[model samples]
Target: MAWYATGTVAVTNGSNVVTGTGTQFITNIKSGDIFIALDNGLLYEVDQIVSATQLTLKREYAGVTNASAVYEIVPTTSNLKTLAQQVTDLIAIYQEIPQSATDAQDAAAAAQGYRDTAKTYQDNAAASASTASGAATTAQGYRDTAKTYQDNAAASASAAATSKSGADTAKSGADSAKAAADASAALAGNWAAQASGTVDGANYSAKYYAMQAAASAASIALPVPITSGGTGATTAAAARTALGVPAIASSNTFSASQTISYSQPLFSINDTSGTGVAVLQFNSNGSMVWQLQKTSASDLNVRRYVSGAFVDVPLSVSNSTGVATLAQRPMFGTATPWDSANLPSVSGRLLNIQVFTSSGTYTPTAGTTKVIVKSVGGGGAGGSTAATSAGQSAVGAGGSSAGYAEVLLTAGFSGVTVTVGAGGTPGAAGANSGNAGGTTSFGTIISCPGGSGGAGGNPSAAAAVNPSAGVVAPTISSGTIINALAGQPAPNALVLVPGSVAISGYGGSGPLGVGGQGRQTTGAGIVGAGYGVGGAGATTSASGAAQIGGAGRQGVLIVYEFA
Candidate 1:
């Protein structure tokens, strides 16, 4: 039967014979085995084995050297006809040529025996030929399988190369993004740790820290009416008390109202200088016409801000209390009305003014006189720098502070709720933005909401002091001097009812003190300082690393009582 097999490719020189290494199928070939190259299907014979990886060929090979060649061996065949002919000749020679009948007969019998043996040999040769044909068919199947495997291997190699290229590109992009985040974080600092704990076992209220404005007070949501602080609580009252809010008054408070007659030194002294008066009466007709005048002993004189300048005019004073002639009220202040120096002496005041940093109660000293209350709400968190820029740096501005003021004789008894606002925090150096401050109130009378938080150099609808802004803007119900819009930007202050003279010293700047604006590549701006000022946005450079924004400031409260 024919024999054939395959082997793994190996190194070779351009010679008549090729060598291979694998399951040793080629080693089984005999002297007559034939070899065929899988690479080109060139054929050759395996004449002999030199070593495990070497072999000799029957003739000088004509094909290119292929170490992976396979070979087939033709089955051997034997014939007896030729041998019988020689044996018959020998038998004839042995017989006597002269005429011995017995000898001649013996020679003929030996010739017949040789002919039968030769016939047997020829039959065997035919059977071997049929078997070789079957063997060749099987070798053909093996060659086809090896060819398919080689084709698949080539395709796999190509795919692997493409995948490696894509992976390299992805790695490069990731590295650039991480570098940007690291730069911003260096500036943002890990305020997350700063916010939740303090080394001195104290809150920021009475302490000092540079980052206090940059870091936020970590919130520990508390239960209402909470006894003290630890882990968790149950009610809103507990949370309020935990933040230092006064305990809810037992049995509720009484409600009543009365109009305190307005009378002052302006009526008694009657200053004659009419420049920069405290009040400029606003008319519903849209003209800024109201001005004050100095009066004679009986009637007061008045001046008006007309066209563009102040103009002096005659006086007409009117009164409602029947006992007196025309009683006049001071329309404007010599400077700012609430100017601490211009205030009445302590002897004339009911006085129960106290400052609460966190929260407590507003008792008013069991007053028989009226009390003046002023408050500023907490500022918003500073904006944050993004980990990576999606076209532009995403660093936001800081929020503005909220403010409110009112005069309460006995009116604010039910007002003045708790929870003094804490300043906002600097957002993490990533997509994260600034945190918002809390709401503060004098009950129903004064609701000074906290400033809205800032974004990462993105536009935000929550403006710090836009009158339409939810809470950061300031407002007042009493004295003209109290309507100061703290925290507003220069010339853009949020004034309540534009007066001849706007309230001064009201706003304290702070929210992003205006993010770095000179250069596009600058980092975030410093936080605002006083009231209502929004934080500046962050700056981005075409070539520099990302920067972070600043933190928002805290809120405040003040009260003045007059006896």
Candidate 2:
């Protein structure tokens, strides 16, 4: 009946060793305890059991703490005998050992006791061999487990070293990038001021402020260094240049201005001595040509030139109409129908005459009269007279005065007139008389007069005048009339005067200064009443009617002499 058990199986938490086994196997094996043999002298450490044949064991240790090799054991004679031999040998060695080598002696004795106890418990000498064998097997398992722990620790150490090296490299790269960025920011601040030299100082200061602001705002990273002297360094340089620190005065509006002058030549009237009439005439087959020259205060006047000679036409004033005219004034140089005196200043005239500013020269409108004048008929007297008894003492109603004026085209004229119509007189004390019509005048254009009001009955009053006032001066284009004329009564119809001249004329009024009619052909007039009476004699280009003399109609052109 040989039996064997595992040797020195000690259980432990990873920290402390438990010293009892089989129940107390590794700490002190009983002599007859069953033990199995193995390659190494160390015993096994069995900590937990899973089933009858299974246990958790530690291997690779001196007294059996480590457990990597774990195996199941069955009792048998051959196995028992093998374990017994081990115990016998150990017991002999312990007894023979020196007392000075006490630890060695004790260790050997412990091994022998374990073998004997296992054999005794089974009560078989054969059990001694089996028990010793089991102890040997357990020792080998502990040794294997210890070896595994050592190997794992060595691997972990190696991995840590590798990771540390990688971390060092990454940190170095990050530091380098930060350094580069700092250097770039400093450089940008220095260079920004340099490019602004092209602009003036005041402008440069403004730009400099802007550049400083932009530089202050940015915090770019430095580039990572590469072993190959790599792409990163070049890319970083390009980025630095792109900061585009604007020039101090780059945004200024660049420009300038200049001064100019204009001039014109003045002409003088000149005359020569010698011929007195320094006039020469030529006839090329009935073609008449004349030239005249005269002496004047300023220079020799070349009055008129024809064929090849100069002619003179003396200047004189006429008393009849108070107008100055040459009987047969010969054409001057280049057959100029008009003179510079008649035209406006050269610049103003050119500006007006020419439709376009740059090109397209214009000659004045042909055959168009630049100046015209006209007259309106006088209002009838308020009271009538039996022609025979008419006397200076008789305070007969006062007659209304006639309306007259002239028109002329200055530079700004555009076929428009400034001539305003005249106002007719009101009725007199005891009679009804027709009112005078308003007359028209022209300067740059034609004008129309106002119509007159009708006369009253019984002890009749004069008609109203067409226009109540004198002609107004021409205004700029599109002239505005401050006041308009009142119209005339019926029966004593209005008449309009006509001539080649441009003028506006109003019609004559009825009794007691009735309002006159308006006419674009001549002028417009109004009539008067009550104390306002029209004068006696009235005449128009078209007609003359009524028992007593009606107010005169307006004329196309009324020429008057001023005293």
Q: Specify the highest-TM-score model's number.
A: 1
Off by over 4 Å in 2: 1-396, 402-408, 411-431, 438-547, 558-563
Error of 2 at 449 (Å): 4.4
- lDDT of model 1 at position 448: 62
lDDT of 1: 0.42
Cα shift from native, residue 340, model 1 (Å): 20
Per-residue lDDT, model 1, residue 560, is: 50
lDDT of 1 by residue, 349-439 (tens): 4334455457766656543256656565666655554433233233344444444344453454524564566666656654345566655
lDDT string, candidate 2, 233-264, tens digits: 22323322232212222221112221122263
Model 1 stretches astray by more than 4 angstroms: 1-352, 366-368, 387-395, 414-416, 458-521, 531-533
Which candidate number has the best lDDT?
1
